[model samples]
Target: MADLFVSETQLPVEVRTHEALSTEELMVFGQSGVKEFEIARRFEAGRAGFPQSDECALAFFEISGRTRTVIREDRLAGGAGQPITYLGFPPARAAARRLTGQGVVSANSETTCLSRVDRAA
Candidate 1:
């Protein structure tokens, strides 16, 4: 099983990486004895018409070798017609943990559920 951790912050990328790494290392190593891991963050894209910038911290670590069957679907928008649903191959649903200053956040698998939006032609 692979674990993913996310943190929302306004700190610079470098500083955020260091902070998240320090926190994740301690938590993961202490709980599961994981030493090897990777940390990533999105870099600023210097382009026009880009939305507001929000920095985030992410960490990926190995927990165990486990596999599961699941389906992920997304709707594709195109010409004036019924939307098409794309089915993703059953992927290895990973178990993840998120660390927060106070404590772990809610662990419900589904974060947000959205209903289809209809636009009149």
Candidate 2:
């Protein structure tokens, strides 16, 4: 299984496998940068039996810091949902080349373009 970490500090975090996490535990982790979108993505991926490859692993961190904060607060307040508004236009794509046996290709091809997104969580 791939490891999970806090993007800002690269701190290692636990990955629960057997039991469901309590709401309190989720709240604490949320404070540390784990957003609902990431949790949902992981859950869906697991349900679909997708391989926990490094490429898919990096997609978990593709959320902008501002959007993360907003989503966190909205969840805390029990808000149904809201649209994300980026201050500016979409960011330009930069190739993250990786040298595989096949050839050089984008490492983060699955990355979602979240503005000002952090690297880890």
Candidate 3:
């Protein structure tokens, strides 16, 4: 299984790869531990709008390293708009290639959970 790590500094721009189309088993890792799957964006979620907020963050999912899925924890109303926190699937290194034309950086082997979204904040 391919595994990678992205820091808060390397803001996610786009996800270009995925493991499989099956959502039967998917888990999102975040600071709060296992995060419930809120909603899956369009299959071509990558083609959607780019995360315009600088406050965007990065999240790691402990699923197939093949599926490079991207999920965002929305921000709360009236609060400072934060960057779209993206939950990248396993082996998210491909994101670099899509985000930037340059090659993807080696991610940390350790997989850290994503921070919980403060929608009520």
Candidate 4:
């Protein structure tokens, strides 16, 4: 079971190889730990408001592996919808201790639910 993790794209592309942006390139985004080889847009062009530039973060998840089912459905710091793509494959799920090296000095209860690795092990 692959998990996914995402955070604000405040670093260089080298930092977040998963980052994808809309045609305008202002509304930047990235994803981590996905199983689906590809995901089609659920909505059409102009179907939803275009994604924004200043909003903070985006998250993606794999709904199932049965049919390459990865859902780009997201939780944003503020807004939604832009260009999209299936970012190849992540080496592992959200099991990583850190997302782009922000900080891991502390771990919360919610963090356990997100990590695939058993830290206690």
Candidate 5:
């Protein structure tokens, strides 16, 4: 196999890129070893009002019928990076509530997620 390498300081984001009629999307690697899909904002990089926060929303649904989320803090430039704990958000919390609350999941089934976009008028 060819050598696969990336800089040590950089993180490898696992993703599947897609372009649909409605929107572009990315299925990124999230918590619990499952996928947590989100709307693509690569085109908005370096823009003032980019959706960077939503990209870090790591929520997961597991076969054990439990859901959890990890919200990472913005990394500081000078110090050794520490992953800030996940704080609750509407999408993450709602998904967690689905798995643990009244909503249900089956072992054989896969968890499906949609990238709900935030638009400006």
Candidate 6:
């Protein structure tokens, strides 16, 4: 399975290429060795009315024959969106993550935003 490793600080994307392991495997060398910490930080920030920056640095790694290679690196900018007015239900977060992942995978040119609005029943 493909895994994504994210860090607030820069990751050594170049040097890591020589290691014969997937990004998930490399996690064992880190302090936490778990990716959930970053996910939690994002959720916590959202809960506290702080939205994450729209920009992200992404590096795609893939296996070519017997070696893993960094195929592409790019910045994902979601652009500015309206301020978060109301927090949606728990499922909203999952939906947001799914949509964002799709954007990253497709390298979409357009930005998408999610907002919650209550309508009369």
In model 5, pairs of residues that clash are 71-86
Residue 84 displacement in candidate 1 (angstroms): 30
Query: Each model's C-alpha lDDT?
Result: 0.22, 0.30, 0.27, 0.25, 0.29, 0.27
Model 3: per-residue lDDT, tens digit, 20-107? Answer: 2223222332212122111112111321222222112122222222333434433466344444433444333343233233332322
Backbone clashes counted, model 6: 0
The lDDT leader among the candidates is 2
Candidate 3: which stretches are off by over 4 Å?
A: 1-65, 68-96, 100-113, 116-121
lDDT per residue for candidate 1 within 14-118, as digits (tens), equals: 222433344334335422212112121111121122121111111221111121212122325443433222121011012222223324232222112001101
List, residue by residue over 18-91, the lDDT tens digit for candidate 4.
22433223112323223111111111111123221111111211221122323333337534532234343332
Q: Mind sharing the TM-score for model 2?
A: 0.25
Candidate 1: the clashing residue pairs are: 1-64
In model 1, the runs with Cα more than 4 Å from the true position are 1-67, 70-95, 99-104, 107-112, 116-121
For residues 12-107, what per-residue lDDT tens digits would candidate 2 score against the true structure?
A: 232222124443444355532234334323432443233334334333333312232322112335564543333221110111111122243322
After superposition of all CA atoms, the RMSD between model 6 and the true structure is: 19.1
Q: How many residue pairs clash in each candidate?
A: 1, 2, 12, 0, 1, 0
lDDT of 6 by residue, 12-116 (tens): 333234233333343354222112222223222342222332221111111011122222233346334322221221222342354357663322221221121
Model 6 TM-score (2 dp) = 0.17
Q: Kindly list the per-residue Cα lDDT of model 5 for residues 1-117, writing each as its tens digit.
A: 011232223322322222221232223323432223222122112122224332222223222123233333346673444453333323334433444453343223222222333
